[model samples]
Target: MIQLKSLQRVNPRDVEAPKKFYVQAVGAGKTDLDRLAYLISNQSTVRKPDCYAVLEALLHNMMDELREGRIIELGNIGNFQIGVSSDAVDTEEEVTSNLVRKAKISFRPAKALRDLLQTVNYKKVS
Candidate 1:
């Protein structure tokens, strides 16, 4: 068996304060890059990757489209549809009703990442 590094736990104070800052101060919605930055900053020490900027831009763009009530599909990842919950139906007949009022985001991981995770083994611990 192989042993990987144990994941570090996060402090709720660290998590919630930045989310509040992003929503209140930046006004860029609840789940924006600022919030993501706060989360990522807590995880890793070295944080000067240019790829992070690109990822943030892409995420913002996706969020913008979702805000406009469009499904944004990323290649390899499943589609994201925004919507809300409707009242429970009390009829025997099947009825289609629209009750979506807010944006909801969902993600499906890429096949490549899934496959890699399924097949790779971590180095054995001494």
Candidate 2:
């Protein structure tokens, strides 16, 4: 069994602030830092210059691909494809119809994230 240090043993300040911000400002409903701290200390969070910047870039790329009517597949994760509704379809059946015009983006979690979630063990609830 792997031994892991509790959040209290690590940078308590950094850990506490974000948890509070998420709960109070973001309205996360409840502030729970135990799991977040575990993942952070274990280096599970994706490393980048800034999380928002990375997300912005990812969204931009996904939107660009969607607009071009192309599916974007993230490794280990799922693919994003633009969706079409029956209401949007034309009555006349036409071969090679350029009906898929609107852009949409979807997300699928990676296998690593899924596996990690499945294997995560929490401390006994008091």
Candidate 3:
């Protein structure tokens, strides 16, 4: 089950109103590539080493494709692409690579993933 915790604002603008709380997800653990490869090996015919090697190469290829302006759609997973946050420019001519202040990888989950999220169970962290 996913764990969550109560979160409240430190300072409330409406002094007369009672404090309100929100629920935020609390991670249970972290899973690294090696652990994932082992799990894959246990579930499939592929060996652990082979799984890790293929995954490592796949990551490099994904990066290369994104750098080349390709939006990668992994089947039943998501679409991945590079996005940029740039400074405001007055005209189209003023827009340039130099204006980009940050670059980020964007992911849009597939229908299956979104559906799964809707069904996942969560519990409050005590």
Highest lDDT against the true fold, candidate: 3
Q: Write the per-residue lDDT of candidate 2 for residues 1-126, one digit (tens) a residue.
A: 222333323346665553321111122244334444444546746543344455567878878988898988888876778766333645566523465555345566677767877775444211
Clashing pairs in 2: none
Pairs of colliding residues, candidate 1: none
TM for every model, in the order presented, reads 0.40, 0.39, 0.89
Candidate with more favorable, higher lDDT: 1 or 3 = 3
Task: State the C-alpha lDDT per candidate.
Answer: 0.60, 0.55, 0.92
Error of 3 at 36 (Å): 1.1
Candidate 3, residues 1-126, lDDT tens digits: the string is: 899999975446777777678889998999988998999999999999999998899899999999999999998999999999989999999988999999999999999999998898999987
Worst 10 residues of 1 by lDDT: 20-29
Q: Count the backbone clashes (under 3 Å) in each candidate.
A: 0, 0, 0
TM-score, candidate 2, is 0.39
- Mark the regions of model 1 whose C-alpha exceeds 4 Å error after superposition: 1-50, 90-103, 120-126
lDDT of 1 by residue, 1-126 (tens): 235443334457676443321111122236756556666767877363544686778888988998888888777766777757665667747445553444346666668657767775555322
